[model samples]
Target chain A: MLLALATASFRIESSFRAQFWFKLLSGVLNVIARVSIWQSVFLHGAGSTDISLPQMITYAILGATTFSTWDATQILREIGADIRSGNVVSHLMRPYSYPVSLYARQLGARAHEMLMIGLPVLVVMGSVYGFQLPASPGHAALFILSLLLSIFLLFTVSIAASMIGFWVMDMLALEWSLRGTLALFSGGLVPLWFYPDAVANTVLYLPFAWISFYPLAIYLGELDLLSSLLHLLYGLSWAVVSAVLVALMWRAACRRMIVQGG
Target chain B: MRQSLSLYLYLIRLQLRTRLQYRASLIIGWVAQAFGYASVYGAIWIVASRFEKLGGWVWPEIALMLGFHVLGYALGALFTLVQLRRMEELVRLGTYDTLLVRPVSPWAYLVFSGFNIEYGGHIALGIGMMVWALPQLGMDWSLLTVLQLVASLISAALLTGSILTMIAAMALVLTRSRYLFGIYFDFWELSRYPITIFAMPLQFVLLSVVPLGYMAYVPIAALLGKPVPVIGEAAPFTAILAGPFMVGVAILVWQSCQRRYQGAGG
Candidate 1:
């Protein structure tokens, strides 16, 4: 059933020719913007930082690609619109669980987008602004593992936030709040290394770090192999906790929707 | 023109009543928007300040640029936020038919209906940034310079609004303009830093093609006696004309698109 739903989503996504092109263009431009900012920083700014320009370039590429994988605002808006238009009730009457079905469909759509748009951006930008390869074979392997974990963690956290839309009168505020929190803590745009010690120390352990910072850190070999393994375990734990939270919230949201006939 | 202004205000008053109907939502929206803008700008500052300077602009200078950028965006968004979302929605749902029959110009009706005060958060924060940075710069302020600053900021706001309005107009023909919105924002993101950071060609594109540089960097650079990209010294003053020119272009495009609009039935 999930596969079928994913296929349906894939079909729906492929139908939008203009959106595909726009996504590709925007994705490429996003990488260029990030890279250019860093380039200027290294050139004109006091360049005493431990991280090399090449590493920073690699981080920017990884950050841009990963950031495109999920958008909290987009997800919340989809849920908000469904609820507002009363289409969510129809979703509830379906055989499968709404959240699970939603995830499956999102997975399909995102898979299409990442391949059709994300890969091209990664390739074109990676070549134009040289990016570093994974530090070592071990790091490369672990980075892949961490990357997959981060995607799951991001989805769980975002869906949990989206569930709050059930109670809120307006999802716009909730959407912006979630987006702001994730963008800051995720270290997707600016790496935590640039952050002051006191702040970085706290933000380092946040669940949001596991979303982008940790994965990229692992790929960049910022951590030793052993520490990378341990962090992956930690990230896995976050994924579990967030997934459970999503389940609980989904239950509570269903009760509220039924009671209020949303 | 005076009558249109009054009607716009009247429509806004009605919208305020409706928007305030949910007091919690209103407060939450305001806080969220403010926090969102604050965090993004804060992150930019934190990262940029790590270095001695970004593209030869000191940290304080960057702050000033950011202040202008955010205030301009907030003002632009205030005028077009509803049209940004509703233009495509109404077109898709076939409700645009009702809007066309209204006696008022569709542009005015849409703009007034979407007038939101929630952007007070961004405006206040932006002003706070400028206030903080201006004193630090220690520039000799003259009446002319002060007037120049005011003109630059207004130009920024007007250019932002005009650009967004043009994109919103695209929904008249292309029903799915959501991705174009993302593309537009990607371009907007470039103006946050000094355009000099980019290569010469990219800088040219920002100046000529998109004219995003006029939004903040070019004007601010001119004011601060910094080297302006493309055109020198006179760039700031030239930027003032960009706003009005773009507004004219926006109106022409909007009118043409409206003429070509076949309604949702098509």
Candidate 2:
């Protein structure tokens, strides 16, 4: 099953408006952090940090862009609200699959947002800090593949989390808990490598790692080519399992909703 | 004054009863919030493990900052944001009209009716974190120090409430152009870290532009008996005056905004 445990991780959160604010403000903080980091470098004037000042700025900027995931739970919340408001009937009447339609719409919005907002932020950052391209053709291709899987994985997680709303009638708590868990595991703010080994191991292997860490790791050439390929395969299996689970969940949810007329 | 206090308590009681009706769901929300907060708390642990210290503040010290930050925000969020969440819409939806006709203050009516228990959990969490961190600092107990911390914590809450009040008032005036104003809230995330780590000019901005430095950093420094760079030793004592001044400003802004408001489409 694609959705397992009704507790998948790595789906995206936050709104485009929120990101617009977050990234734009981060641009201001990015410069300040750069100065302090460089001062630290000059202070000892030796013993290099794993990530440099320029690279850290890139990470900070990219961190904002990447943190906005394929937010399936948001769509699930939308559908759940429809059910509550007695508007879900229209969606049920439509010829196409409601869940698929939700995914497609989000895909389009994410693409549009990435291009219109995310890319321009990167371009501005690039002008100042000097952007680095992904390591090689093979690695870049694998990174793209991993990114797509991560989005799918996240979407499934959101689906699982939102399905609880069918029973609870309020998805806020579930969503909050899911978001917290995802943020801790996803390494959206910091690289997993920075974490202690015991904590890092458990966090790294989790599905949330694919969300922000893995794809970005490949872009930075932090992962080796072979390991990248291996991770891509592993992530694909997780996505496949989650999808199967989600299909079963959708069936059960619809059956219950159909009975309840909600 | 007693009449108003009774009104406020009665309203809060009504909300609490309504929430308690959904007993299972309400408790679950607190659990969820705890986990959500726990995740951010975990990040601090990870960062501390990797680095010896941040801005000369250890994890215990940082916890004091973070704890007070949560305390201030929890208190402020308890009252103001319920309206600000839909301030522009409240006017458009004519919800404001209902409140305007009320004998009690519109601000009180707006927030009290939408009172949330989500903040109660945050207060507990904030205080729990502070208590947890305090013993680790190994400081001698002093009646004056205890008083200063309590005063600073309350001041921080007032500062937060004032900021949100200003935003709520602004939301009423600038509906279509409210996007930029809403974004200001996001900047408060920066204050979660050690403000001392930030450079001089940015530090100034945090204090003036956001006033978050007062929320955690300034008060926190006072408790630690550490003087803020350049601002000197007097900053801690100044926090007491700043809190009331900020709240007064919030009331003044909220009042002016209410006066300028001529109802929806008027």
Candidate 3:
């Protein structure tokens, strides 16, 4: 699933004009980071006394990626819109699985974003801030693996949210509210570590932390392999539970479709 | 001017009527916006609680600044929602030509044509915050202070509206630009806090290039009896200047865009 998503994301960068703006924004971010005090403050606080280029790049990637997950629900809404418009029937008739197809498209979109927007921004920000690279190859590998897992967990959460549209008409408000909550709580706008300890402790139990904080923590060296593995275990558990709920919802939704001829 | 006032009232009434049709949705949107903004402010408050002051400004002063900023943003967004959202559509479809044909000034029509009455809720929220924060900040009430606050708000509205108009003008040139407006909005979002939080160069950029500093900073500074840093140094004079500058810039941009417009469905 992760491989498919990564492939799709890459495909988008190759095909779309979105790369121009992505590059422009990334360049602007790089310039801003180089000149802006906010960048210095963030770097000073996040890294050890001395920040390196790689560490800064890693932080930039982690920040952008974490924030990007907020868009997952929007992808779900697009899927729901397809279903409402009878487009889903065509996909259902195809040999390929419906969920997998949607997932592929989403993965493509994210891959495109990661390459065009995320990578350049990270590189620029890293160079400007002089961020340190990971101390060892093993840590880098661990970070990459945890990041992949985080993407999967985020995808699952989005699927779950999108499934709610099948039961409710006009999921716009609900989707927005959910996205806003996720952005606020999932360490997107502000890192979870910055929150009061009591709040952070409570949020750790929620699924949102797995979507952003855990993966970011792994990259920041805040979490070692053992701890990352434990976090992944929690994420996989949530994914299974969410997948089951989605299956149940899909079955019920199918029944509704037949009865209502929708 | 009398005709413009009447037209503004008529447009506002029409918007109010349209918004009343979706009472629930309007209320929900308002609540959601208030909650979202409040959460960010809450975060700021939490951070400030750890420190006695930020950039030489204490909590109440910060609250006042936020109050003005929120009020200005809400007013700008509500009044200019259609222009902000549809600048690209107008440019692409050449619908802006219709405004040119109307007897009213194209700039006036463009800025005031589409209103979101729902944003009235935001104004209420801003006022509530200002009132709430006033006592917390240990402010003494006076007639002059009240007048200054009202004047500052009016100036803020003008400054914000004009800046949006300037961005919209860019749309006329960059038709089909996906995130032109989004970029503008992101800039606006960046302005929510005091410009002091940013470094000196950024502070200059915000003041001169974007003029966001003129929005709430100037007015709030004057109201708080602080030395005005930029245009706010003139206080009421600069406050009055905002509207004319907006009208002038809007007219200039519209005139230039008119030459580029080729007409719709050609």
**Model 3 alpha-carbon miss at residue B107, Å:** 5.6
lDDT of 3 by residue, A113-214 (tens): 666676676676556545556545666787677677667767767776777677655455556666666766676544566567888789887878777777
Cα misplacement distance, residue B146 of candidate 2 (Å): 0.8
The TM-score measured for candidate 1 stands at: 0.95
How do the predictions measure up, each by TM-score?
0.95, 0.89, 0.82
Candidate 2, B207-239: lDDT as tens digits:
776677787888888778776864667778766
lDDT of 1 by residue, A1-262 (tens): 9999998998998998888888788888788888888898898788478888999999998788765433635788898898887788888778998888878877787778777877888888999899789999999999989988887777777788888888874788877887788778888888899988888999999899988899899999999999999999988888888888888988887777753543
**Model 1 chain A: worst 10 consecutive residues (lDDT sum):** A65-74
In candidate 2, what are the lDDT values of residues A212-259, reduced to their tens digit?
788878777778999988988887777778778777777777888653
Ranking by DockQ: 1, 2, 3
Question: How does chain B score by TM in each prediction?
Answer: 0.94, 0.93, 0.85
Per-model interface RMSD values are 1.3, 4.4, 5.3
lDDT of 3 by residue, B127-226 (tens): 8878877777666678977786776677778776766676666666666544555565555655655555566776777667766676776667666667
Each candidate's fnat, listed in order, reads 0.75, 0.48, 0.05
Candidate 1 backbone collisions, by pair: none
Off by over 4 Å in 1: A259-262, B264-266
lDDT of each: 0.83, 0.71, 0.64
Off by over 4 Å in 2: A1-23, A26-54, A69-77, A259-262, B176-182
lDDT digits (tens) for residues B56-111 of candidate 1: 88878999998888898888888886566667888899877788888888888888
